[model samples]
Structures are given as C-alpha cells and as structure tokens.
Target: MKANVGTLDRGLRIAAGLILIGLSLSGVIGLWGWIGVVPLATGLFSFCPAYSLLGLNTCRNRPH
Candidate 1:
C-alpha cells in the first residue's frame, strides 16, 4: 500500500504503540494493550487501511 501516514503522525503512532506494548508487557495496561501492535505495524509501514478506506491521506508527498 502507498504511504498514507505522515512523519509526525507516524512518530506519534510509533511512540504510542511502544508505550502501550510496554505497559502490556509490564502488566500495567493488561492484555488489551497488545492491540497497539496495529498502530505499530501501520506506522512502520507508513500506511493505514482505515485512512485509505476513508480517502484520508496524511502523507504530503504522494506521487501523482
């Protein structure tokens, strides 16, 4: 998939995902925090399925 996530958004997502995963592993946020993997994957890949479906691209340098 094309990159739909921008730099700032990707950074935030990665940070949030890491925090959630860390909390989960530390038993602070419980198993549900594992869901952070979704954001982590999307951020790493620079793509978001939901954004594509909604036609909402945060990327500013998409090729025409």
Candidate 2:
C-alpha cells in the first residue's frame, strides 16, 4: 500500500491508539477501545484504507 499517512498523522494515530488500548486494558474504557488497533496499524504501516478510498494523501515524500 502507498504511504498516505504522513509523519504527524502517524504519530498522532500511534499515540491515540496506544492511549485507547491502555485505557481499555486498565478498564477505563470498554472493549470498544480495542478499535484503536485500526489507527495503530494504519499508523505503523503508513497506509489507511479509508484515506485511500477517499483519495486523501498526507505523506509529502510519497505520491498518491
């Protein structure tokens, strides 16, 4: 997949994902927190299916 996620976006995704997972594990949030995996994976992989489908690109170093 193309790297549509940029550095800032990736960082935010990762951070948000980790926070959600942490909250879930700590019981601060319900199982829904597991959804954080989506962002985490997209962030780590630098590819977001939704972004691709929406024709959005945030990575300056990569071409859509």
Candidate 3:
C-alpha cells in the first residue's frame, strides 16, 4: 500500500497509540485504550484503510 500517512501524522499516531497502550497496560486508561493498537499498526505500517477508501493521503507529494 502507498504511504498515505506522513511523518508528522505517523509520529502523532505512534505517540498517541503508545500512550493509549501504556495507559491501558498501566490500568489507567481502561478497555477503550485497546483501540490504540489500530493507530499503532497504521502508523507503524504507514497505511490506513479508511484513508484509502476516503481518497485521503497524508503523505501526498512526499518522496520516500
């Protein structure tokens, strides 16, 4: 898949995901934090299915 997630977007997603995971593991965020894995995976892979279906590209014009 094309990299529809840019550096900044990926970074944010990763950070948010890590926080959610951390909080959940620490018993501070509850079960909702489990959803963070989705963003984590998307950021780690630089691809998001929703973005693809919506014709969105956060990494547009980016080289690499």
Candidate 4:
C-alpha cells in the first residue's frame, strides 16, 4: 500500500503508540492501552486503511 501517513504524523503515531503501550504495561490505563497497537502498526507501515477508505492522504508529492 502507498504511504498515506506523512513523516510528522508517523512520528506522532509512533510516540503515542509507545506511550500507550508503556502505560498499559504499567497498569496505568488498564487493558485499553493495548489498543495502541493499531496506531503503532499504521505508523510503522506508513499506511492507514481508514485513511484510504476516507480518501485522506497526508504524504507530500514526490517522484514515484
């Protein structure tokens, strides 16, 4: 899949995912924190399925 998530967005997702996972491990947010894996996967893959369905593209133009 194409990279629909931009650099900054990807960075934020990674950070948020890590934070959430950390909190979950520490029992700070209960089991809900484990949901962060979704963002983490999207961030790592640089492609969001929801974004594609919504026709959202944050990636800047570049020679392909």
- Please report, in order, the local distance difference test score of every candidate based on alpha carbons: 0.93, 0.93, 0.91, 0.92
Q: Candidates sorted by TM-score, descending order? A: 1, 2, 4, 3
- For model 1, how does the per-residue alpha-carbon lDDT over 8-47 read when each residue is reduced to its tens digit? 9999999999999999999998899999999999999999
Q: What is the lDDT of residue 19 in candidate 3?
A: 94
In angstroms, the error of model 1 at 50 is 0.3
**How well does candidate 3 match the true structure in TM-score terms?**
0.89
Tens digits of lDDT, candidate 2, 1-64: 7789999999999999999999999999999999999999999999999998998999988642
CA-only RMSD, every prediction: 0.9, 1.3, 2.3, 1.7
Cα lDDT for residue 8, candidate 3: 94
Clashing pairs in 3: none
Measured by TM-score, how close is model 4 to the native structure?
A: 0.92
Model 4 per-residue lDDT at 55: 87
Give each model's clash number.
Answer: 0, 0, 0, 0
What's the TM-score of each model vs. the native? Answer: 0.94, 0.94, 0.89, 0.92
Scored against the true structure, residue 10 in model 2 reaches a CA lDDT of 97
Candidate 1: give the clashing pairs: none
lDDT of 3 at 64: 46
Candidate 3 local lDDT, 1-64, one digit each (tens): 7789988999999999999999999999799998999999999999999998998888957654
Evaluated against the true structure, the overall lDDT of model 4 is 0.92
